[model samples]
Target: MAMTKKIPDTIKGANTFCPGCGHGVVVRLIAEALEELGHADDAICAVAVGCSCLVNVALGIDKIGCPHGRASACAAGIKRVRPGNLVFSYQGDGDSLSIGLAETVYSAQRNEKFTQIIVNNGVFGMTGGQASPCTLIGQKTTTTVDGRSVNMSGVPLDIMKMFGQIESVAYLARGSVHDAQNILNTKRYIKKAFEAQMAGAGFSCVEILSPCPTNWHMEPVDSMERIAGVVSAYYPIGEIVTGGGLNA
Candidate 1:
């Protein structure tokens, strides 16, 4: 029998994301992963400030709103206390890679047993299109109106590269949601990240390259194509790590 798509009960209310925003897709994928892992009723989500805050209302699971860039710390505490529950943190580039960089790095250093899903749209979508740590050189944002300059900003951070160096990081992957096939593949990566946590393999994170049509001042379709043509070029897509134990 053919399979039908289903939205887990964890998600409720209108998605409310803009036409081409990838947050909605990422949220749905996370919900599906939790349900598939039988964590629908047992998952705790720590959401950071920014657009990620919406996940609390969108996903019916127990959720805690963490201070900006502090979701990782919050998730770590929740996981320790709830040890038996599935714990994950949802954050955006601005919140996770910029303001929350320290929290993120140390959590991996300690091998926190939880999943961290970062939406890397490169721009600060919630606070106008400002350049974020993941914003590419030559990319234009409100702060970098002309274009990002390496001399001034250094370089776009390759978070996976940093996490890959940490001994505690059991799984690290980058995925995109620009097309149907990639979306499905991203879901696979997300699921594996969760599975790694369940196996007690340590810190796991899935960084998803998403599109921001509204912020990019492009039509929705154009934004999707841009992600295919430009964004993915720097970020790339694939499982960078799958834990030493879980093959592929």
Candidate 2:
């Protein structure tokens, strides 16, 4: 909990995120990392649509709104034009791994010097409870009325593992925010991703397994439990890849 301290000049309004959601937490971690690294004032965030848009409410720095699934591309452009700025993309699983897959892959392949923080809640939180590309097997969403059927929907995309094949990628990790210990670890992973960017190591990314109680049809507490017990199990937390290797 202590990892979050809103930056000075943050928008003076309550965040619109749902109760117990993790998007706020992840955004705060990013803000903390930017401040600690002395880039808070120069940080440029490209936020994608869906629940990701709400993050701007609490973000204090300047930002741009990227078209759905285009946060990575936008961030890449920002970094290219203003190489001194700390640029990062904030996107949801549905946006990053679904509509934005091509851009995300190409950016990593190019080793764009930037950071990405993806909040994978398994469902499309803002646009109805639809199953996202990261949805687990048997996970139910509004679209998956009877739980996810791998035969019909195919397997959940193992993006973190897939990123390991990209030699240009600097760091890749998946962390959940369902509990205190994982929150601390997740913040660390986020910081590492930013540090990688600052070092010009290469493209950096961290996937955060967040809870979506409103869309998942469960209590907030239950959603956290699902992330801790099942979601993380399938995703396999910790650093999946570090410095472009399958280090997990």
Candidate 3:
């Protein structure tokens, strides 16, 4: 018999993300985690504006589009209203770390029982590759043609390090999708965040170091190399917090 398709039901069809972009990989990981955890039908995503918005179409599951940088706030509301549903927010560095910083911080402070996945490509990828809050100090972008200067722009925000300090954060981790091992690890971290949310543990998040080939003006392979090389140096991969919230 021809092998039955094993594609996760959460994945409806082909994605429109740029070739070599890591958003596709991260979306796949989310689907895999939801399917494995038996939350495919119960999952609800609050997608942010930008490239992250496309995830709503790529994943067949129910989702709501939030205002720029408001995905976390929206997801938290959904989770609060429908506590049984598995709720998560998909956002980028520009949305999560920059504009949505207040929402993200207070959500953790309130111990909102939900998961958030932040894709940190270091730039405002969908908006002409502007330097984001997480953009490296010397990384070049449309707004930082001379490479980011500390004097002009403050240091890149280490979101995980900052969020991990919250007393109500149940889980916080950073991972990359640049290699096979790292991809697998990223999936694990994502799954753990979802599990934490399902357990009624407080807020949880996973910041994924993703690649933006088109925005970065690099080939796909070189973009992956940059994630493994330049990106990982500042945003180290690994779990930061395990348990320190309501359930913990």
Candidate 4:
């Protein structure tokens, strides 16, 4: 596919995600989805720190840089103020599910009229590959060199399953970008979440299981393979909740 031409007008500059990081793909998908949904000009995004922070420069949309894991809260504030605008939060697993957990949960509880995208790349890609809330059992991150044992780290937080039960959440899905087919599916999930927000269906979230080659310390292709195999097996893929316009 000629992604260059597909680059929507919403993208202003280049992103700084590592060479093999999946954040870039997710960013492109967001831009395309917003443009396709006719909300490019009306969209505002709150971006969390970590690798996700790099998206600030890439997306031309009005963006707010939240402290640490406050992206959801920031996005919620924006939606509350400008109820007519389309707002979303771009966050990393570590950033959203950890310190920002309260914001994310409350946003769903209130059924905020906005969208959220969480990149679940297992490790904290931006800060030396530390263990994150989504890091899988037996996974080896810098903080978990001996592998994440069940006793030490418990279990990886299944964001989709955990959040799906929130009655206020109008839509929820988890996808990957390890391959072409999965990439398309992930894009569809993102677009659907955005559509749910546009329809005023309340809070929507799409969790993307992405590869962090630089953090995983593997070849780019090997990291992709890990996502297609191990990571996907652990997190699974597809929509976890259905409501609003989520099922296009």
lDDT of 4 by residue, 1-248 (tens): 55554569877777888999999999998888888888899999999999999998889999988999899999999999998898999999999999898898888888888888999998888889999998889888999999999999899888777677776688899988889998898889988888788788889999998889998999989999998888888898998877743233
Query: Compared with the true structure, what per-residue lDDT tens digits does model 3 show for residues 196-236?
Result: 99999889999999999998999999999998887898889
Instruction: Write the candidate numbers in order of decreasing lDDT.
Output: 3, 1, 4, 2
Candidate 1 residues 1-248, lDDT tens each? 99996768888968877777889989998888888989889999999898889887788899999999999999999998888899999999999999999999999888788889999989898898899998888888899988899998989998998998876578889999999999999999999888888888788999999998978889888988988987888888999887643332
Off by more than 4 A, model 2: 1-13, 244-248
Which structure is stronger by lDDT: 3 or 4? 3
Global CA lDDT of candidate 1, please?
Answer: 0.88
Candidate ranking under TM-score, highest first, comes to 3, 1, 4, 2
Candidate 3: where are CA atoms >4 Å away? 1-5
Q: Pick the candidate with the highest lDDT.
A: 3
Write candidate 2's Cα lDDT for 107-178 as tens digits: 888888888889999989898889999888888888888888989999999788778788778899998899
* Pairs in clash, predicted candidate 2: none
Off by over 4 Å in 1: 1-5, 245-248
RMSD per candidate (Å) reads 1.7, 3.0, 1.6, 2.4
Which residue runs of candidate 4 sit more than 4 Å off their true CA positions?
1-4, 244-248
- What clash count goes with each model? 0, 0, 0, 0
**Candidate 4: C-alpha lDDT:** 0.88
lDDT of 4 at 186: 87
Error of 4 at 141 (Å): 1.0
Q: TM-scores of all models?
A: 0.96, 0.93, 0.97, 0.94
